[model samples]
Target: MILHKDFASVVGVRRIGKTSLVRVSFNDLKDNIIPLSINLGRLNGKNYSVEDFSRLFLEGVTDLIKNYTFVVKLPE
Candidate 1:
């Protein structure tokens, strides 16, 4: 659904399998897609700006590109 629709949100109560589902999805798609998954609970009461989220997202993506065996080929 995420791949076809470009977006999907998984929500459920704590201690459920939401994280597990996302982890499985990422593992399956990591070679072709870079994902940014954050612990929103850590920001529940904090004053975090969109720029902060963007920074964290980019950091995660760069880390994946740097550490994983995923390949990114630029167009000629």
Candidate 2:
């Protein structure tokens, strides 16, 4: 289903299973969609600004997608 073209945003409280529903739905479109889940809650107490949040989220998504491409894993 087209999102903005067909429907508006679905609003709900945090941790209310919104992501679960989205994941389940997105599964059906896996052939065309590369879903990325970022837990922005990681910034809960960090007091990150809007720009900070955007940067962090992008970095997290990039890492999630590219981690598998590395020839060797780094030590934790």
Candidate 3:
């Protein structure tokens, strides 16, 4: 769908195929664009601060780059 370039979030309810759609869509774009998938259902409550979220998000991105070992370069 090439959505990450245009928008940020996809709103939907549980068991309504949100995760499945995102997973498939993100996978299609991952080679060219970065993707960060968070299970917000697990982030509810006191432990879920914005700072924590930012850290987790960066960690996921770093992990992706490391795992892929891509030919396309990243900034230093």
Candidate 4:
């Protein structure tokens, strides 16, 4: 579904392994796709704002870019 540009949502009660399932899937597809995993539950009790979410999202992207390698080919 992801390869076809379709999005997937895993809905279930807490502690039912939803996160684990997504993590495993992401690991399996790591070579083919870049995965950004963020846990919003950490902000469940704090006074968080949009900036917090944006920071987390950007941090994830930055980490991925720093850890992964991409190559571009040029025509000669």
Clashes of each: 0, 0, 0, 0
Global Cα lDDT for candidate 4: 0.77
- In model 4, state the lDDT of residue 41: 65
Q: What C-alpha lDDT values do all the predictions have?
A: 0.73, 0.69, 0.73, 0.77
Better of 1 and 4 by TM-score: 4
With a 3 Å backbone cut-off (N, CA, C), the pairs that clash in candidate 1 are: none
Top candidate by TM-score: 4
In model 3, residue pairs whose N, Cα or C atoms come closer than 3 Å (at least 3 residues apart or on different chains), thus clashing, are none
Return the TM-score for each candidate structure: 0.51, 0.49, 0.53, 0.56
Question: Please, what are the lDDT tens digits per residue for candidate 1 over residues 1-71?
Answer: 46544777787788898989998988887466756666565453578888877777777777776776667
lDDT of candidate 3 over 9-67, digit per residue (tens): 87677789988888888778746766666666666656678987887778777887787
Return the lDDT, model 2, position 48: 74
Q: Candidate 1: misplaced stretches above 4 Å? A: 1-5, 28-31, 69-76
Model 4: runs farther than 4 Å from truth? 1-5, 11-14, 29-31, 45-47, 70-76
What does candidate 2's lDDT look like per residue over 1-76, in tens digits?
A: 6454333244477879977787788777745555556666667666779987887779878976785355767899
Name model 3 segments beyond 4 Å from true: 1-5, 28-31, 70-76
**Model 4 poorest 10 in a row by lDDT:** 36-45
Superposition error at 61 for model 2 (Å): 2.1
Candidate 2: 10-residue stretch with minimal lDDT: 2-11
Compare candidates 1 and 2 on lDDT and give the better one: 1
